[model samples]
Each structure stands twice: as structure tokens, then as C-alpha cells.
Target: MKYTEILEVVRQYIEQFYDAKEDSTLTFHNFAHTHDVVTHATKMAKHYGLDERETFVVTTASWFHDTGYYTGEANGHEQRGAEMAGGFLKNLGVKEELIQEVQKCIMATVMPQKPENLLQQIMCDADLYHFGTEQFSERNMLMQEEVERKTGCKIDNNNWRKATICLLESHFFKTGYGRELLEYGKKKNLERLKRKETRGMMRKSHIPNSCLGE
Candidate 1:
């Protein structure tokens, strides 16, 4: 299939499905995030010299990935998203082989990502491109809010900062294209997060003597 045709199909799918089942609580996994992934995936596909068919698969998978968050299930959203993508694409007359590849691309985006090939690697890195950008902190805050709302358990600043630090230190873009494009920003973002975490710890330890019942 031509790129324009499949791209439009993927766009329409996102608009209709997301509108019908949009979860207001999923601040971080909403349409904007999906769009970002698709945009980044396209860039990486071009950089990696993906053929037309491979580009189609990557874009389709990116569009439908994380859709299962609308289902209100915290765990296994990747598998659920893959299943949703399979059914939708199959209904659109997409070949079984293409649909399965698309599903694999979607599944490969799960955290601690394990991409088995170039296509999967591109999509996985695109899915997490925000981790290395100036918008990382803004997106990070939205993620924190979503977690707090969904779990109904407040995560204090210190705990959240520590967890965020660990995640940034552990995360990396899988593809060479991704690393060359994002590694500097990723390291900068990590430094910013480390400083933030340290400041948070210091704040917690700095108790004022005025409140000591003197």
C-alpha cells in the first residue's frame, strides 16, 4: 500500500477510536503523545532508509500503540494495544502478515523495551523520544499525575524524584539513529533530573528550628 493511503487510514483510526474512547485520566498517553510517536517514527524511518512497506508498518503501529490505556488497565497495555491494532487493520483488508508485523511493533514498545529488529527498534525509540527532549519534565509531570489519579495513592516529591532518576538512568534509545539524534539531550535531561532529586532530598532534610516547640 502507498504511504499516503496507509497514513490517512492510521490517522482516521486514531481520531475516531480515540474520540470514542478517550480516557481523560490518561494525560500522558493521549492523542498528542501518539502523534509525537508517529512523527518521531517517521523521522527515524527516513534516517534508517526504510522501504515504503516498512514505513507503513511502523507508522500504523505507532498510531495504535498505547491505545489500550483507554481500556483502563495499567498492566499489559502493550498486548491489548496489539490485539486492538490487529482487529482494526484486519477489518481494513490489511494482510495477515502485515498486521502481525504491526502488532509486533506495537508490542515491542513496552517498557524495558526489547526490539528484535530495526523496525521494532525505531518504533520503540520513537515511543520514548520525549525522555531526551526539553519537554521531558512536562511529560514527566503528566505521567506523575496519571499515576496518582489512577492509583489513588499520592506519590510524594522525594519518592517520585528518586523513581524518575532511576528511570532516566536506565533508559536509552535502542537504534543508532536514535542515539545519534537524542543522546546529548538524554544525558542533559538525566543531569537535570539528578540535580532535581538531590535538591528534593536536601529540602526534606532541612527542617526549620521554628517548628521545634521552643
Candidate 2:
């Protein structure tokens, strides 16, 4: 199938099937994020001169990577997304072999699961392309908003700082291309987190007497 046709199908499926409550991030994880991943994956594949099949798999994976959020569970969203994407693609006349390959790429986005293969690595990196972006803080804020909207929990400064630190410490880009491209931005984000934490601590500890102000 043509890439454009496949993309259009995916877009239509997302609009028709995405459930905001079950997949809280569904609002933020709209077609724009899918498009971003596709763009990033394409760039990485081109940079490394990936085979045509590998590129296709990654492209399809990018299109459906976040579809699992609609499943209402964060733990296995990738797998669920992959299953949904595969079914849709197969119904759209995509070959079974290619569908499986695309599903593998979709599963590569799961946290704590590193991508061992090159194509998987690219898809994984593309799924998290924001980690190294200059607008990392803004993106992180959006993530915080997503969580708040989904779980109805507000993240205060200390909590947000802690979360940011944990994310920065835990996240690792599988491909050398991502590391080389986004490492510094990731570090900058971490540094910002550290500063925020410090400021929060200082504010909490610095209570002053009213008489001292006079």
C-alpha cells in the first residue's frame, strides 16, 4: 500500500476509535505526535540508509505506536496498539508478513524493553523524540498536563521535579543516532529539573517571622 494511503487509514482509525477516558493521553497523543514520530523515524532511517522493508515497518509502527493508549492501561499499551494497528492494516490489504514486522516495531516503544534490532531501535527513538528537543520543558509540562487530566492528580513543584529527575535518569535512547542527536538536550532538561527541585526545597525551608520584616 502507498505510504500516504496507509497514513490516511491510520488517521481515520484514530479519530474513529480513540477513547479519551480509557486512553487519557489520547487527547495529547493525537495525529500530530504520530506525524512527529514518522518524521523522526524517516530522518533516522535515511541517515542510516535502512532497507526499504525496515523503513516501511518503522513508518507503520510510528503511525500506530500510541493507539494502545485507547486500551485504558498504561502497562501494555504498546502491545495493544500493535494488535489494533495490525488488524487495521491487514483489513486494509497489507500483507501478513509486513503486518507482523510493523507490530514488532510498535512493541518496541514499551518502557523497560530495549530494542535489540536496528529498525526497532529507530522506532523507539522516534517515539521519544521529544526527550532531546529544545522545547523539552514545554513538552514535559504537556506530559504533566496529560497525567493530571487522566488521573485527576495535580503535580506540585516538588512532585514534578522528582518525576522529571526519575524520567531523565531512567530514559535511554537505544540508537546511537538518538544519543548523538539528543543527549545534550536531555542533560539540559535534567539540569532544569535539578534547579526546580532546589528552588522548591529552598522555598519550603525559608519561612520568615513577620517581626524580622520590620
Best by lDDT: 1
1-214 per-residue lDDT for model 1 (tens digits): 6667867987997889889987778889999999999999999999889899999999999998988898759799999899999998888888999999999999998888999999999999999898888999899999999998888889996788788888878888899987887889989988987888778668756867676444
Q: What is the overall TM-score of model 1 with all chains considered together?
A: 0.93
Per-candidate count of clashing residue pairs (backbone under 3 Å)? 0, 0
Q: What is residue 188's positional error in candidate 1, in angstroms?
A: 1.2
Instruction: Candidate 1: count the clashes.
Output: 0
TM of each candidate vs. truth: 0.93, 0.85
Could you tell me the lDDT of residue 193 within candidate 2?
Answer: 80
Give a tens-digit lDDT track for model 2, residues 96-191: 988988898888777765786999999989988898898777777777788777777787857876978997899988899999989888988888
Q: Where in model 2 is the C-alpha error above 4 Å?
A: 1-27, 208-214
Q: What is the lDDT of residue 135 in candidate 1?
A: 93
Q: What local distance difference test score does each model get?
A: 0.88, 0.79
Give the Å error, residue 74, model 2.
Answer: 3.1
Clashing residue pairs for model 2: none
